[model samples]
Target: MKQTTFLLVFGVVLSFCQAQSETGGEETGGEEEHVELFTTPATKMGAATSDFGYNLFRALASRESATNIFLAPITVSAVLTQLSMGGSEQAERQLYRALRYHTLQDPQLHTTLKDLLASVKAPGKGLSTAARIYLARRLRLKQDFFSLVEQQYGVRPKALLGGNRDMKEINDWVSQETGGKVQRFLAKALPRNSAVNTVSAAYFKGKWVTRFSQSGVMENFQVDGGSPVRISMMQQDNYPVKMGADSDLSCTIAQIQMQDDISMFIFLPDDVTSNMTLLEESLTAEFVQDLSMTLLPAQVSLTLPTLKLSYSTDLLPLLNDLGLAEWLETPDLEKISGQAATLSSVNHKVVMETAPEGNQYPSATSTTSHLSYRVDRPFLYLIRDEASGALLFIGRVVNPKDLSI
Candidate 1:
């Protein structure tokens, strides 16, 4: 099986050192200076959450060698963060470490997360993420925890109605949140004796800045240790892109612009035999942000595969492997309720689709060199938001035919 890693990073090209104040008019030097508070310095929060996402990705990759793994890091992180609000001191500390928030020591972490999520889910971004806490029926939540979660995460906790009914309701809600892209989110009823379950999901369908030609041709894509698979491959002539190479990782990096301050970065290894361990380990929110800034613009003959992929999984095992076994197995959510409450599961799902569509149609153009950028082999790719440097969706395609269905 081919070894590949995929990552989704959001919000690139912003300075995180100085924080942005809320939008308002401030009296300065007897003059009313009005500043639009459209954005906040949530980069620190984004970095912490993305670090957690990468950590989870590495854990999953270590277990599954060739399967396609896709997840929304922000959704998972946000759910965990919200749950921690109702946890005891020990649980809170454990979650903070899992989220890499202890390293930041920022008091306004929750607020920053709220603002970041709001921006990511804002209409017209081409991507959306949401998280919710589903407590077991008859488990009474504390007033403060309920209020804070609703105010910060913007959702009310739901009671698991039990049996097949619970499944239908949750699935319907998930479908509504994802614009009907994920109709059947849950295949079975909620876990028996489950006290709390965290649900997170993301949906994306981006338009390319430079659309690919509709005339795609079936081409051979080499899968490691397996026969080459034929798939529909889209192409564009003289596509404007930001390109770079990492000699240490032995991979070529290319960033293709998209609408709504989003960019897709592809990391294609030099050869099918190239080891992606180093590249995967080196991924961090800050590192990727720097790499995005350093990539130089160039026009290239680009060929990419059309993608429509969906992934859903239980994150309890991965979280356990990450040293949260004690917390997951115990009942220390006293702040949330006086009764014994243990985490039953963490459910996550993601769906992403992209084609040759863009603001304008593809066209032929002159180029300086024969810089052909063909993704005809196993490679890792991620969708990132340039405005805030947040990772949206990340995955690797060993064989395009695997998820095309």
Candidate 2:
């Protein structure tokens, strides 16, 4: 049996918060202080797309909380930036509609979020309403763009591209969607010498709404091994920081309140450098439940530094390391491709980070990422319910290298 390839390189690029010596400072406009969120449609139709989107977001959130690096606004902002940069108007519209539909279809998700939001301090009563409208509009625009792309390119551009002439058209479309930021990247990253036919892209960016000031100087912040690294620190005097402890590890959950009732929870491992493999291995639906029970309130001064980083990794090895072998080892990807063809392999590369901008007290983090999959061999992939472990989207990437420009 051929080895299956599925890779996921996920991590915080860089994070920084700026603050003065005091609490309650005026908001600044910069990269370090802004946070944005966006979503996309992975498949054209059916329950797969819907379920994948929801599960992806939930898994991301859960992971952040577990790692003590919860930054919801930044995560959302990063996703939106990618969509805006890489997605077509129709693709964007489809994403928006899907998110809205999900919210409506599952009222409990909304209710739970609303309850969480209600507990936070609202800067202005109308701010939540404005936030909702902003989100709605963003989703709508994305959905419309997705539809346009489908109509113009057809569902499978590779199938449409029978010859070299068709490749040019597909490339042109890819160039237009990425605003030229990624044309060359895609060209170089994708497998050129293969029987593959079609390709798709996803990009993301995000910033904080209330950015941190960069003026404070701090030294010797503890990392995993008690080695203090001098980092640019953002100080918050009074905010919500909570703590919990289990026999295996101590956990901290911090809520960075955003507009309305939405807050980002940061979960920091008590032992930052402890073999993360155990934590990753132990991650499951029940793990999330256990983490949620750990949520409580505390008041402390937050000292986070501004840092920016980016990386790309293949997800196949990582997925295999995590015990998902059937997809990579078997030849059953026909169900996903909707065709009776032998699959290639699936590989994903992602880049993301938060960086500081100015020398002043107020600063922000700007993050961006690009994820691409080149299925040169056959393998299986699935999108599942984060809460229930239910499979939503499953398919095989057999000829990713042969995909048209």
Candidate 3:
């Protein structure tokens, strides 16, 4: 994936609005914002990215896999943490664990994210993520919680009279924040009178750094059990790629540069006959970073399937299955308002599309192929923000035809 041309996106559109009585507070980006965010060192970026990446996919390990699974862990982390700003005791601990951090005392976690949020906010950065909260009329909001969200996450709660009325606003905001890459934030307006609803959406459109040739050819892709599936394969010869083999994971690991500060890593298992179970177990932020540090550039011929995929799922059940039902309980969020308001629903939608940049490869490298790396089997990919080493999206492509939502 180069510059934003080839997208491997992870987006979560989770809404956490429930029913509540009467109230007062400005409808900011998030109902949870009221104060300024604390600024901390950027050095913690690596640790923060590592923590979130590891905890996120491990949680997905228990998820249903008959279909594609795509997500942005940071979206989930931001939502849970905003809740934690008003959470206490065990409830907060649950969020802490979900975020793959020590306890709530970890300033680096939020601050590191704060910095990343700011970095992406710079002029014209294609990778973007945003969270918005819509609150039911009269619902109370905490000052500290609101301020923390506003300052750290750069979102303000947009207080609304009803969920239905707020749907359009949420959709528009989401679309604008994601550079118009995602617009359908809410299929229909939410039920009227929910206490709180938070929506987080991420969208990406990037170009390839090294353009693949115009002549696209159909190739056989090996699905699990060696079943053959044909897909349009994009090819490039003698391209500079960071390639390596992870014997322990039994997969070919390599980094595909997108542009400056962004890249996609593909983990293609040697044994295409096997399921992704082993590869799933091997994914961790540390392992990915290790590959980044150890892998060296080489002139390689790479063939990867042209990717075009989109998916959506209800995440509450998955969160519950991960043993965090207690964390979503109304009682657990007493600090938010000391009222009976629980998370309503969590929704995630992701879109990924890739193609050659149409820029002709240098004539010199067009013919030479020292090492061949063909992604002709089930494989996992990570779209990362290279500067902070934050994983933007993660998913596996089994059947290219099965990319529908």
Q: lDDT winner among the candidates?
A: 1
What does candidate 3's lDDT look like per residue over 133-166, in tens digits? Answer: 5555465766666676777777766667564557
Q: What is the C-alpha lDDT of each candidate?
A: 0.75, 0.29, 0.63
- Give the winner by lDDT: 2 or 3: 3
State in Å the error of residue 206, model 1.
1.3
Find the 10 residues in a row with the least total lDDT in model 1.
29-38
TM-scores of the models, in the order given: 0.86, 0.42, 0.79
Write the candidate numbers in order of decreasing TM-score: 1, 3, 2
Pitting candidate 1 against candidate 2, the one with the higher lDDT is 1
Sum up the clashes in candidate 2: 79
TM-score of 3: 0.79
Error of 3 at 349 (Å): 2.0
